[model samples]
Target: MRTDLCGRLGSGDAGRAVTVCGWVDRRREHSEHLAFIDLRDHSGVLQCVVDGARDLRSEYVVRIIGTVTLRPEGTANPALATGEIELQDCEVELLSRAEPPPFPLDERTDVDETLRLRHRYVDLRKSRMQRNLRARAALNRAIRRAMDAQGFVEVETPMLIASTPEGARDFVVPSRKEPGSFYALPQSPQIFKQLTMVGGVDRYYQIARCLRDEDLRADRQFEFSQLDVEASFATRDDVLGFVTRAVAEATVAVAGHDPGTFDRMTWHDAMERYGSDKPDTRFGMELAELTPVFADTEARVFQAPCVKGICLMGGAETLPRSRVDELVATCQRWGAKGLAWMRVVAAGTGGSALDAGVAKFLSAAEGAAVIDALDASPGDMVFLVADERPLVRHVLGLLRLELGRPPVNDGRFNYLWVVDFPLFEALNAEGEPIPSHHPFTMPHEDDLPVLMSGQPLDGEALLGLRSQAYDLVLNGWELGSGSVRIHRRDIQQRIFEVLGIAPDDAQERFGFLLDAFRYGAPPHAGFAVGLDRLGALLVGEENIREVIAFPKTQSGADPLTDAPSPIADTHLQELGLRVLPPA
Candidate 1:
């Protein structure tokens, strides 16, 4: 007899005969005469009752032929939909018995993550994992719906392609047919998606998988999926606006709340105000500049070039000297030389009271000016970094994020548009300028002459020459980034020159994209949203692995599958590879 899924049985089907099939979630002997089993499937859970003569165990594959009956008076469980009713079984068959599980399947059980990952299949049976997977499915569906509604045609890009080593390392696959040749998995479908725009697929979208060989973080994985999109005849504003709306809709649909509208900020403003492009706006405590106020001061720390400060709310008098020292140590870890701090206090009849660190260096007027500039209150403390602009910004930005309270369950989303990114970052170890985002990003039209003139451009000037690039940030986490691509061959060539990519190297590495651009390429731009990060955020988990069915550990090792293992010699021969002995 055919059976229905366990989660489908409910109070509406009471008094009707039904066949149910699922894994026994939990089994309990209600009394000597009766037994109740909680059965679960991918959809949800249901309760099943059988005579005590039959034996059932947890995780056993079971089939029951019974009538769905409403629970007796005072027995209905309001916590579950199927709780109001249960299946009264007359016949039961134990399809497969299960051994004792290594770990509990309930959400409340606190188990070691290493053990959980080792038995991911069993771990996925837990309620938390079930919820995460369901939320992931719903999020993907919402993304598809949103993209389709925006007139974007869904398309698939290639998986294997040439390696353009720029931002991150590539995972290479040896080619058996071509000896000594290798193919790298696409870091992103960046080139292919741009080519799709050139092919005149006015608008395109793909739930694409990307692989990158890089250091792992809570939000990063070896192979992750992204909601990739590209649009022809679109500007930076059009793409940013589309992503903002799509993110808001997706967040509301998946998390049951809207993220609301995003605030726009330039790279400079973000650095000066919050010290991070992805700033957490949920709380106060913005960074302020004190360079002008300390320009002529006798303070040795402020004697250097750029000086910026951030006032910790209600932190001046309360923050201890040891805590301030610890903050300084944290800055040093991020490559800052040292950290300088001053406590704001009330002015006395004799003179202005100040922290010992800067008391002798500052005159009364200068001290007051510093306090007024930062808008410091009596109880607030101010921390300053004095160094080059980039280091100062980096140090302060990191401190700002670190000092804020852990993210809370606030329903409102703080969205931001980080625009005006630099086209080229500083020179690499080889003294060649590197692409800030990527080589395909178009330089600002007005900056083309400056780029072609071959004049040496510093980081500040290059940053001011903004590209048509932008990143979508939600609550200080970068959701995605995109830029209007370089379509003109001459402009593309100029970018290559700026990045120190030789003519021969450019033709070899990016010939396919260049040739495609030559054939009627339109003005197009695209962005990629990290599906794993989005899923994790929607499920309210700290790490992306919580939502993934099978995720590798921080070391990029999969405990369940034991991947990255050495292959047999025969298999290696097929791939034209040989394992070298450890030197």
Candidate 2:
């Protein structure tokens, strides 16, 4: 419809007659006779000179035929890519007219999210949204290319499938034909991709759409996409390599630089050191052990089984007493009995010393030891939690991030492979160990005897068993997880037994998968990367919705379409369903 894009004309195109189409971004009147129009398309905005009689307004779709010429001296806009050139002698053809936008279209305005989502079609026209969507597209393209280069065959999986337990509620589709039967939307292609490995597809990949009936958060939604991959005859390292190469390529395509290599940390170490399986190693307010220092203390508060603290550099100068009190309350809310705080101040000897209302509770030696253990310097603040080991890690871990974690943009990429996850997260009410990843995850080779042993496995023994599972974490976000599959029927059955799933229950839940293995299943492993989270991180968006085209609000409501609306009784009857009144 046009000879060139509005933003594509440059100084080299000077004296060339061109027809460009775009929406008027901004209009500036030079005098009674002349005006400047910033015409915009997806490429960018371009300056166009037109007669004031044209009455071009913001968001007016227009096509123009003009000669591209260098901008007049002292009038060039250095901010724009086409700053050096302007379209002159223009004839404008008005295509579509728009009312004044409900809100500003520029990034400077922080529009209410609900209002923006209500007019998402219009909101997507802003440059930031355009850039984010394009970056996501580029990331997807790069991932596909890298996977193909590594001999993976792209495959499509079913959207509506039978859903077994996957740790999240499923969005089920009722079948009219069967009346009472339902098909659950996939939370992931976890089973289908694994089945592909059993079907002899050596390598398979899919950018699968997944749906989950879970509460929405900044990084989550009812529906999302994952780069799902599975391979037969592959070890855990082999699968990690496949995903790393693809992720590195995608990162380079969107971030413009290789993140280099990912570092490895055991799940146990992550929980102990940073209090999270997905640790953000970008900054240095790490948790410090203080249990030994207080073991012989007379202070009752410091005599707990575990004691840990985090040193916030310069926190003493910034955090007032009221703020420290708030932090203590927050820790109590997070399941701690209480949080202890100490301010590091100059001592009488000119060394660091603790100063707080609670400082008198500790002896001078105890105070000096606390300072030494935390590497406390003057102007530093120390937060300590003394409780059970797990609670201490949990409280201090969150405190560390709350005090020192940088904004997502300032925190550079620090990819980590968290491995050696325990086979069971914990024991259930019946004292049976809960599966960490899944029943199919292979036990560590050395731990096979513990699983196969005829001895009764108690909670401690079960919790100590390690799985061959691994998770890929980026900047404290868990991107995805995978594990080496247990192909042997005996091993799979043994895991099921340990989890208290009787033979009949195991057959009922995963009989198809087990049956498929009987036909000959090769050893396999796989991983999935959340595309929304990855795209958001790459583009410096804190929320995944920024990179999505039409995302539901945090409440899972779509203001644009007003979805989750009512259905007619007639249609409900046809579907053999009835809506009940709210309780």
Candidate 3:
């Protein structure tokens, strides 16, 4: 180790003798008496001129003592941080010699992901991974600071807790002490944070680790982190304010700008206008209702349950006839009966220019109505889907994205809140209801009487009930959600009744939490932000794996350690466990 990092050296250190240590990025031999080596550390790379023997190779960890000097005229590397100066008269001491990397250490192209993961220790040496992980750490620190400033106390929740078969499948741990029993990992600190509120910790937070035994995607991992928070006697606005402050802090720390006041949209508005709970309000092509436009039409299909369309300006030229067929096939795959489309042709005629798809199903007047309703201009393309309202939204939503409708960046953060979601969805004909957020979420005040009425709800009535829940969405990704909790036992019991969880079953599954409520649970609310997703967003990475230091593959395998491997028989026997042979 020397007096400076290889990257931090500059012309200001000229005529100064300094020591630097790092891996040799590259070595160039001009002559036997003079050779140059690019020295690299976490900070960056520096060029070193050694007027002696040249034995350096890539990844050879070395220390150098040399005098910094201005580079010869016309020899400056404007691309490098230390380009203006080079270390001369260097004495090199090899600390470690590294074998040639399996993949080039400086490669910028795609490498086999599995291979890179297997050699993850080597893969982490790349500059991109370094920057990503660094940004994550800095963002985490920023989150902690924000929580601290907000008078929140960080608390640790249990890793081995009782399993609540409510949300995602849990990764269970066999309890040797209790022979056939098991402890499940926490998916979120949901229960414990609420318990903290019951224990009178008015404001609480935790940078908690969570696990879920679910299918993996780019944005999901079996084990992830979140900023868990809970507060007693807090209103919906209070929780939103807290989240905004923390999110702003994290975003500014990484992106170098504060996302001004986040926009708000009701869940109904999001779904109606953009066809998603987390709408990407970045660009156009908003979904338009064509129900009224076709209500009086003789076309049976077009006048049916619901009709929605999107106008793709200039899409007629950009997207070909084949693309329309592909899009229609995609919609059908998503359960749509069929996809309807019309490409507008610019003509100096006295009638409509609708050229294809269901154009035959409409009169010139109906076609004109469709054109004016979607605001279609010359050469524009209109795509429509008809079915049940939800299916219509779902199909058009998928088509909108397929047509390149997504988040619009306004040179800043597109932070937003989606609120007033349905409290329950129909589970089945057995009369069981699925709580949209969870069983304990407080129903909207206006819907309180509906819940208290004791009248069994079915279909639309159940779906129409809204909850106090809110989700923080950024660029179409749902960052996190929170809601006011039902502090009263009666309201909680009503929810349990709706979910078909009898008093006995409720006590058996959530006995501890319910028992805690018996001791006067306070009116509390909370939110947990997916730290991985937040970090990925701040770093502008679509996949959360990029920001994670050691991310699992989509298959949930740890390539580096080859984890989830078979355990020793003796070890399994200690816990009275055995691995069954594959069928």
Candidate 4:
């Protein structure tokens, strides 16, 4: 409310009488007559010299008018932007007095998340949170600009709509007008954005709020935001290009560097090489193939349809026996029959040899073969899993991350586009192939013949069939996915038939969409970027909640608002709802 911001006063403003308003970050006594007050605003902190007797405490809101002057020799705080100058002979006005903070406000403090969340109004004053919040705003703005520049129109989608279950459990809202009906919150602008394409909006976009009644994790929350997009008459490459442009622009805008061209990999290759569809390619420790190495072995543990191992460089010395046992327990918990660990040691012939775990079960030649297969160094520790291919990949993928994955922000950005996902993940008990993305996804053109054939497809052939779906992954986190839509009704019906969804049942669930398709739906493709995850990555935060302004705790409770609390009986009755006892 004055001549300058606290942080905006520098040496160039020397001899200038300026006024500044901010909260008192710190107060220190310099002498009986003078004191130093670190006045802070969103920009930064500025040192103000005031009367020592003036009452000033941390977080006290105040305004000061003083002449900017150079600090005494050798007292400059090079760490601060206004380090070279100080505001002297200040007139202080106490705007508001603040009580002592419940927890330390410094960046070094490790306050419990619940405590911080409960006092979020205060927690937000910290520099880290301030930076994160501002970065998110900037990222959103950049995304909007990118979309707009790409000739996409921003459209708002409905917050309440009929509950058509997709993947995650929907957070339903009771319809007050209709006694027993409910409206579900949109998980994404997925359907509405697609509808926009059908309605002839060639390109559509929105920074949509999404909700899912799902378990919370570091990267997931019940409520989140995404950059939703859809475009009519767009091919797979067209959608990828649009999404890449937006994301790369946002990354550069927030992180100040281009991520260059995003790398591409087939889902099969990704799973085979790194054991994850979203592979973290920043570091090594790749899963090694060892099934053939033990094809003729006597070790029962290694006698499985699939066997894979990962070498933890220098893990032999870093991981103790207890830690190795814990890894074994962890593998077992992940459904592996047993985890086989071998610490590479010097052999009689100077080459490395496998020692410990399943080492004794193998012959000398087999032991050497195991060591060679994994490319294990003498000081390394190798963990092996033997089971079906899927189990082996799942266990070893997690194990690889446990052993060698870098911190979320430690490595350079490695944007990836994973394509060629299976058209169906698996077959259900009724021998119907489960749709991977959705029933509407267009099967890859090359696989159309197989689908069109009258002969029933086998589980292997169905599972091997690739859809046109693709995912945008960053550092092992799946940002979002999209696929080309089947514009033709016949293709859609055929997909439903494959999934064992009868015409009547399909009509009931997706009647509106099917009816719209009869009016000539255009071929479209789209993608959504999880803005929360992207923001977290841009700000170097491991948890998406850190970047979110007000986020639910891991238990999905909002400490600030005390949300999810019980409602009054009268309120529930208004919506014709009643609470029921737990079974």
In order of listing, the candidates' clash counts read: 2, 0, 2, 0
Off by over 4 Å in 2: none
lDDT of 2 by residue, 1-583 (tens): 8999877779999999999999999999987779999999998888999998888899999999999999889888889899999999999999999999899999899999999999998899999999999999999999999999999999999998997875899999988888878899999888889899988889999999999999999999999999999999999999999999999999999999799989999999999889888898888788888898888989989889999988888989999889998999999999999998888999888999998847888888888888898899999988888999989999899888888778888737888999999999988788988889988999998898988886788889899999999999999888888899899988988888888889999888988888898999999998899999999999899999999999999889999999989988888888889888999
Model 1 alpha-carbon drift over 4 Å, by segment: 1-10, 316-323, 345-362, 429-431, 452-460
Model 4, position 165: C-alpha lDDT score: 66
Q: Local error of candidate 4 at 298, Å? A: 2.0
> 379-421, model 3: which lDDT tens digit per residue?
8899988788989998888788778644332444688899888
Q: Write down the worst ten-residue block by lDDT for model 4.
A: 365-374
Task: Quantify all predictions' global Cα lDDT against the true fold.
Answer: 0.81, 0.91, 0.88, 0.91
Instruction: Report lDDT (Cα) of residue 115, candidate 3.
Output: 87
Per-residue CA lDDT of candidate 4, range 485-546, in tens? Answer: 88888788888888988999999998988888888799999888899999999889999989
Cα error of candidate 4 at position 418, Å: 0.8
Candidate 3 all-Cα RMSD: 1.8
Cα lDDT for residue 487, candidate 1: 81
lDDT score for candidate 4 against the true structure: 0.91
* Greater-lDDT candidate between 1 and 4: 4
Query: Model 4 Cα displacement at 19 (Å)?
Result: 1.9
Candidate 3 C-alpha error for residue 31, in Å: 1.9
